[model samples]
Target: MKRLKLLVTLAKKGAIGEKVKITLRELADELGISPQSVLRLLDEMEKEGLVSKEVLGRKTYVEIDHEGLAFLESLCDAISEALYNGVIIGEVISGIGEGAYYVKQYAHLIREYLGFDPYLGTLNIRVLFPKTVFDALCGVRPVVLPGFTKDGRTFGDVKAYRIRINDIEGAIVVPSRTVHPPRIAEIIAPVYLREALNLKDGSRITLRVVKG
Candidate 1:
C-alpha cells in the first residue's frame, strides 16, 4: 500500500506518461517519508516497470509507465466495485429549470431505450459520499441515449442507468455535456418522483441498481 500510495503521489505530480522533474525531498515531504525511503520505493517501482527515472546532474526526472497507470485504474475499479456495489445514497435537490427542456428533447429515446415515458422534468440528487455519480455507477453498464441534431443544434449522447427509488423505477441520465457538478445525479421516471414520493429538497433517498 505504501508503494501504491507513492505511485499515486507521483501520478498526481503530472508524471503519467510524461517526465516531470521532482526532488526526493519534495516527494518525501508529500508522502511523509524519509528521502531514503522514497528512493528505495522508486528503485523497486523502476525495477517493476511501473516507473522510469532519469537523473541528470542534480535533477531527477520521473515518469509513470503505462503499466503504472493500468495498475491505478485496476485499483480504482476494485475500490469502486467494493464500495458502490450498485447502490447510492443522496439527498434530493432542485435542478436549474433546464431538466424539462432536455428531458423533452430526449423523451423519445428514453421511451425507446429505457422503456418508460419520462416525465417533463428530472429529480436532482446530490450524491452523498462518492466523488461523482459516474464514479458511484462505475462497473454498472449504462443504457446509451444516442444524440441527434435538430434545427441545427446538436445534442450529445448520454449514459443512463436503471435504478429504483422507494419502489419507483427510474433511470439516472448523465449527459455528455453538463453544467452540473459531478455530485449531482439527474433522475427521470415515468412520473414526477417528488410528488409521488412526497420528496422535498434535502430528502434523503437510496437508489438501488436494477440489473437488465
Candidate 2:
C-alpha cells in the first residue's frame, strides 16, 4: 500500500493512462528513498501490471495502468468509507439570509442530485474545531450542481453531501467551490430543519454524514 501510494504521488500530472514526466531521482526525493530504490519499486509495480514506464534520454515518462487505477479506486473507496462515517456536532446559528435565494434558485439541481426537494432556506451550524470533519467530508466525492447564467449573473458550482440530522435526511451545501472555511456549514433538508428539530439559535445538534 505504501509503494502504491508512492506511485500515485509520482503520477502527479494526471490519473492512469495519462502521460506524466517524472524522474527516478525526483520520485526518490518524494518517496524519501534512493533512486535505485525507486527503480526497484517501479520494476516490482511493472511486473505486477500496475505501471508503465518509458525512458527517453535522461527523462522518464510514467503512466498508471487500468489495473493500477482500479486498485487506487478501491483504496480510495475504503478510505472514504472509513472517514465518511463520523459525527459532527455544532451550534445552530443564523445565516446571512442568502440561503433562501440560492436554495430557491437551485432547487431543481439540488433535487436532481440529492433526491429530495430542499426547504427554501438553510440551517447554519457553527462547529467546534471542525478541521478534521471538514477534511474528511472534502475527501469524499460530492454531488455537484453545475453553474448557470441567471439574471445576467453567473452562479458558480455547488457541492452537496448527503447527511442526516438526528436521523432526518439532509445535506451540507457548499456554494461556489470547495474552498470553504471549516468553521461553518450550511444544511438543507426536505423539511424546515428549524421546525422539524425544534431548533433555535445557540442550539447544539449532531449530524451524521455518510458517503455511501
Highest lDDT: give the candidate number: 1
Q: Tell me the alpha-carbon RMSD of every candidate.
A: 4.4, 7.6
lDDT of 1 by residue, 92-200 (tens): 9889899999999999999999999999999999999666787667778899999999999999999999999978999989898878899999999999999999999
CA deviation > 4 Å runs, candidate 2: 1-84, 177-180
Prediction-by-prediction clash tally: 0, 0
- The CA lDDT at 131 in model 1 is 65
RMSD of 1: 4.4
Q: Tell me how far the alpha carbon of residue 127 in candidate 2 is from the true structure, in angstroms, after superposition.
A: 1.0
lDDT of 2 at 103: 92
Which residue segments of model 1 deviate by more than 4 Å?
95-122, 136-160, 173-183, 190-192
